[model samples]
Target: MSENVLHLENVTMQFGGVVAVNDVSMDVNEGEIVALIGPNGAGKTTVFNVITGVYAPTNGRVSLRGRVIAEDHPRGKMRKMYAAGHLGEYPRSVNNTPDRITRLNMARTFQNIRLFKSMTVFDNVLVAKHMHLKANFFSTALHLNAREERRMREETMELLRIVGLENECDEIATSLPYGQQRRLEIARALSTNPSMLLLDEPAAGMNPQETEDLSAFIREIKDRFGLTVLLIEHDMNLVMDISDRIYVLNFGALIAEGTPAEIQSNPDVITAYLGVAEE
Candidate 1:
């Protein structure tokens, strides 16, 4: 296995004539928390889109586990293979589909909470297990497979416990406090059994105390789940405190890549944010 779980090389994406991401290359090593941070319109989320198959890159390539999914040449034709139902052949794609990526052991949380608001907190996590559940829809709908149904419920409760939400299993998702909702989102994503987790602003709308607890929770889950996390966050404190390495993007291009301490001292990052040279 490669040391890196995800790799993007000279990747670019454009909407009409507006380039959202340009010639950006990055590598996320296994079991590390890598933060992608930049000001608005810096193409932070654009990079995420390309990697997660939300948008096909106009140029460049994306690779996962040594397979090229997107590239500048004929190899970029892997996208066609994916479209043709040869889903197992490609690990990356210029236009890879999201479902295929999820099946590849990569799962992501959205910038906005996307829980089943009408469902219980436990059900929110339970829904994710559907992808891995072995029971057929027919068996589940008819309740003919008692064993499978029981197994699913057990798995769901176990996942809730892992996220520390076992007690809130029956509460409506929207009724949970904001911070717990965020934790529920993480638990839901984890139910997919992902090897690589993509978190988009997991700390958004969180108070200081909540963010503090979230920071520790993230680290704990990373260790417990043995997951490699690629996070997009604007909270400098959270990013600096938790990420092992940081990648800074500006104007759809990578500006700097370094450790937290190094990024804290980088003049370009300060300039990009404050529009003034560091004293």
Candidate 2:
């Protein structure tokens, strides 16, 4: 059997009285391209936030490679006000910071393209490589790790080359076309050398050709880098075309899950997206 890369069990996120994600459970196996899709406000990105440690769930647990990275139970006001699913089952509090999670061999790109606007494309990627540096703080500060720095830059350039951004390396990051900017963001995430990648709306602003190219690129990198991918996307064509399996959500609740063909034919998914018919 394939190894499990990421898992979420009975996960829920409550802000004040608003429950953004409700008792969701999902998993992605190594080498699989899993898609989490739903209509707007279905809590897809909220799920991503919970998974990446941006928000500690009000209840439930998140695991990576059999290691529990985050777990919590309702407390204080929530304990009395909200009916938190799976409460008391996961009593451990292990809320890791985002950087801590990234250091655990996982990386993600944002829904809105976030790049270092003032930095060059090369520099943007080079900065991400610093997380893996072996040199101490003083060695880096004193410039004593010249050899390692050179190797890092070389790897950054090679990464840019692989992502078709080497030609734009010297250009200011914000100066690139919108599609290439998105590509650069993913390339920056890859610089961290993650085995699992979470892409949030990667094709959000792309034209048809760019979207097509992106589908190919996602598959290419998955094979090239041996990556397991989980993505939130609105483009049905792209999702159906690439995903090994899919999970559907509606109103913060998981509605259905199956292969692309199965999701396409699922009545609950169709009703969630299209609404019920009148009598």
Candidate 3:
């Protein structure tokens, strides 16, 4: 059986009384491409935020490689305010920051493209590479890390080459076409050398052709880097085409999960997306 690369057990996130993600649990096995899909306000991105450490979930645990990386349960003031998921399942809070999570072999892109607009494509990637630097602050400031810097630059170029952005390395990030800007963001995420990648609406603004190209590109990089991916996408065609398994969420709760064929036939999923018909 494939090892589970990521596991969420009874995870929930609440903002005051609003339960954005409620009692959600899912898994992504090593090397599998998993898609999280649902209608608007389904709390898809909320789950992504919880996973990426943008928010410490109000309940349950998030595990990576069988180790619990984040966990918390309703407590203090939250204890009385409409606790969701399993209550008190995790007594301690284990909120790892986003950068710390990235260092621990997880990286993500945003729902909206986030790039260093003032920086060149190469520099944008280089910044991510800085997270793995070995030299101390003093060495970096004194220019003694020159060799390491040079190596990073070379690797950045190689990554750009791999992503077909080599020619645009000198261009300002926001100056690239919309599709390429999206690719650049992914490239920057890749620079972190993650085992798992979380992509938030990667195909949000793409035309059909760009979406198709993105599907192929996602597969290519997955194989090339040996990555396990979890993505949120509304484009059903791309989701169905690329996902090894699909997890459906409605109103922050998982409604269905199965292969593409099974999900396509599921009544709950159909009703969630299209609503009930009058008799």
Candidate 4:
């Protein structure tokens, strides 16, 4: 019963001599909108990949709630190298596939929109429901799980309504306006029924008005679905307006973490973004 919805403990990712994430650790508590913000090459997305199991940590642990989902380390000669004089920051760790991690009350959307291009909007959302489908293979093959089908339909429609995408249900997923496609991606993620939602650059290509609407929509869904959201965003305005707490990264290391106001004032954060001035 830990209050933290997600925790990354001493996480590090090393490729040969380069450490993409250097002993980075952070927490997302229940019902909080937390953001990871950084300049390009700051390793923000690397942390997300570790959390979602896209890449196992070279060393460190990733946990959702209280269960350890992913852990990794150097292998064979790498192990021997580390043992001799090159120790991984933390220790050996475990790793989980993306799907397995998704089932543990967590789900995420990509930075780029990754919809099923040929599928209808409804089917894109409907496809996520397959994760929670209760019908067995035989029941599914025989179409005997009428109850499950009805439930899935009800769930999908409810999600579409929640995201204001009900009218687009029959449209081709790729044909929707850019903003709606973003909304649809979220709706699809929502269909997985995750308690926590991880959004990567949800405002990437949005205009000021769209970003404004998206910020509001995100907050609305957090309240409506009772979700704890951890987001990676470059839209400073949106990040500042919506985040309860913000974590800043520079060169694969956390430089600051605090409330939005505090993050704004941190000298290190300013330096990271604006760079050092000549003396």
Q: All candidates: CA RMSD in angstroms?
A: 5.6, 0.8, 0.8, 2.3
User: Which parts of model 4 are misplaced by more than 4 Å?
Assistant: 80-92
Name the TM-score of candidate 4.
0.94
Model 2: per-residue Cα lDDT at residue 153? 94
Question: Each model's TM-score?
Answer: 0.88, 0.98, 0.98, 0.94
Q: Local distance difference test, per candidate?
A: 0.83, 0.95, 0.94, 0.89
- Tens digits of per-residue lDDT, candidate 3, 1-279, equal 899999999998999999999999999999999999999999999999889899998898999999888998887888899557467568888989988989999999999999999999999999999999999999999999999999999999999999999999999999999999999999999999999999999999999999999999999999999999999999999999999999999999999999999999999999999999989
Better of 3 and 4 by lDDT: 3
Model 3, TM vs. native: 0.98
Whole-model lDDT, model 3: 0.94
Query: Which 10 consecutive positions of candidate 3 have the poorest summed lDDT?
Result: 82-91
Q: After aligning candidate 1 to the native by TM-score, how far in Å is the CA of 228 from where it should be?
A: 0.3
| Candidate 1 Cα outliers beyond 4 Å, as residue runs | 70-94, 277-279
Residue 127 miss distance in model 4 (angstroms):
0.7
Output the lDDT of residue 158, model 2.
98
- Model 2 Cα lDDT, one tens digit per residue, 163-236: 99999999999999999999999999999999999999999989889999999999999999999999999999
